[model samples]
Target: MKKIINEMKVRLPSHSENEAVARTVVSAFSALIDPTVEELSDLRCAVSEAVTNCIVHAYRDLPEGEFGYIYISLRLYDNREITVEISDNGCGIEDIKRAREPFFTTSESDERCGMGFLVMESFTDRVSVKSKVGKGTSVLLRKIFSPHTSEEE
Candidate 1:
């Protein structure tokens, strides 16, 4: 088997648009891996949450003209592992530990459930976050793909 990596970038102005972009990117990658419908849905949801966090939380105060970019990289390794990395150049988290707590949202008015990180963690096999207060944030997610018996000869 061989490994391939593909990357795409999208500018996010708000949380709503992130969902659509996430769906599109995840669908494309899932197609490459030939994941089940359920798995594809899960991947989309997780990617959406990560992207939303960047738009809603990272660039919350930025002006309309100011935009945050999401870079997504998908890697398929020997048909055994699928790795996705989503990054953004925005306000970046000051404290990753506190932010990841379930229901711990910085925006009470927005009614954020704070479950984004939790959902991402639950859906993917591995989830990692790297950020600096003034720099940016990068989320790395990995999920191992096991070919179904039908897919194997």
Candidate 2:
């Protein structure tokens, strides 16, 4: 079992405004490894996409003013590995495989590019999803920081 270096769990309202909140918290938590600017930017973008999914898709059915909650957890492990989990307890996804395909948005509008999973996968070493209809979905993302990567090569 890998020991945890540090961790935090937060429950935020699934609101468009909280996207920035999530990004801020993620940036601060990820600073421990002193990741390169590019690496940090990638992580932030991935988090944004995940959070937006929770707000846009998961809670889509909520009465206009009503809102669901988004759960976010950040963990740092002993081996320079960081894991971020974003979850929601709202209407869940019906299909995981098809939803992951590029340009596959369920939204009727053109706003959603259907690239959330791809973005997360591109920015992290691993990305996993779990969902149950009416039970919501959770996206887990893992990244291993390597500042010397450029120097070593």
Q: Which stretches of candidate 2 lie over 4 Å from their true place?
A: 147-153
- The models' CA-based lDDT, in order, is 0.78, 0.91
**Best-fitting candidate, scored by TM-score:** 2
Q: At residue 104, what lDDT does model 2 achieve?
A: 89
Report the lDDT tens digits of candidate 2 across residue range 14-95: 8899999999999999888778888889999999999999998999989989999999999998777889999999899999
Model 1 pairs whose backbones collide: none
Show the lowest summed lDDT stretch of 10 residues, model 2: 144-153
**Candidate 1: C-alpha lDDT:** 0.78
Model 1 off-target regions past 4 Å? Answer: 5-15, 151-153
Error of 1 at 136 (Å): 0.6
Provide the clashing-pair count of each candidate structure: 0, 0
TM-score of each: 0.86, 0.93
Candidate 2: global Cα-lDDT? 0.91
